[model samples]
Target: MTATVLTIAGSDSGGGAGIQADLKTVSALGAYGASVITAITAQNTRAVTAVHPVPPEVIAAQVAAVLDDIEVHAIKIGMLGGPALVDCVAEAIAGFAGAVVLDPVMVAKSGDVLLPDDAVDALARRLVPRATLLTPNLPEAARLLRDEAAGDGAAMQDQGHRLRALGAGAVLMKGGHGGGPTCTDWLVTDQGAQPFTAPRIATANTHGTGCSLSSAIAAGLAQGMALADAVGRAHLWLHGAIRAADGMRIGQGHGPVHHFHELWA
Candidate 1:
């Protein structure tokens, strides 16, 4: 059976992150990709020029329409942009029995805050608890954990545990934003924490790494892969995507990883 995965996210005109990247990653992993755009962003590799949020009712309607018609097996959420949007999405997908991958995309690639400072509370209280997996990069984890110590791996592991306590089934604290030769991500559950480590590939085509990773995980779940297996495959796929697109350039600033890297060569 073909797996259908949904992305509830903002639209990135740059084709890097948000729904654009989510769709690409889902399709690249051989899953049918569907989307409910939560916002429309005027953005490029360098910056987000403007953001227009979709109405909460419309967002809910889209989720309803999709769930009503399609067999959605998994969901990947990103760039909700505010508390209201986050709540709407959380409420819409609350009934879903399948996997949900929440990428707490609090900031843009240029370091601009994507979510409101106050919405962090709403995200933790309303959305994080509903997620099957919460994927937060170092900066996002720091914001969620509210700790300067979150910059270290040990602190990150503890933070992941705390995040799991926030009611997530699992918490994947991404260490890509942390400085080191290897990027280490910690997956924390009630059982314990397991780390996934990979060498940091220096490349400008990293604009969609977080979105792509979560989407890949969602796709794997949709296809019925085990949770740990999905994460490992996502890590491998993203590594290849980053390396394959290293010399290939697109926009003036950070470009997108080659989602079709395998098909091209």
Candidate 2:
């Protein structure tokens, strides 16, 4: 039986990130993809022009419709535009007994704020705790861990602890934005911390990397892979996708990682 994966996220018109990337990643990895769009953005390779949030009722309805019929084995969540949307998603996942991948998408590569200033608190208080796995890049990690004494690995550990306290089973602190010869990501939980590092792949095709990584993890979970193994495979898959994107000329600015790299000639 094919595993079903659901993405509760915003729509990126460019198809580089957000729901589009999540869908592609899930499908490519042999999982069925379903989506509950929380918002829509007029965005492209350049920048986000505008954002239109979907109504809370509609969001709830979408989630209900998908869960009522399909047997979702895993879920990936990204870009819930506001607190209300976050709440809507949390409510949807109330009884879902599966892997939940949360990509805390706030700042875009184009430097646009995908999430509002006020929504951060709500996200931390409500959504973060419910996630099966929370994935946050450096900046978002810092913001989430603002109370810790000076944002560093130590502080990140503190933040990760707090996130796990919030209820997430595990936290993956993605260090892609951290300035280092090697990109280091930490997977932390009440159990322990395991760090994974890889030489940074130099490429501009990282537009949808976060979305892709989370979706890949979800796919692995859907396929009944262990958490550590799922994360490792996702890392390998992303490396290949990035290398594939390095050779393609998709847009004028930052392009998307080649999602079909596994099949590309």
Model 1: which residue pairs collide? none
Best by TM-score: 1
lDDT of 1 by residue, 129-206 (tens): 889999998788878878664767788899898888889999988888788799888988887888898999888779
Write down the lDDT of every candidate, Cα atoms only.
0.89, 0.86
Q: At residue 85, what lDDT does model 1 achieve? A: 90
RMSD of each: 1.1, 1.7
| Alpha carbon deviation, residue 112, candidate 1 (Å) | 1.8
Task: Give stretches of model 2 more than 4 Å off.
Answer: 147-155
lDDT tens digits by residue: candidate 2, 1-265: 8888999999999999999999999888888999999989998888889999999999999999999999999989999988888888888788888889999899887889988867787888888887889998877866766653224566566677777887789998887777656777788877788777788888877898999999999999999998988998898888788878978787777899999899768
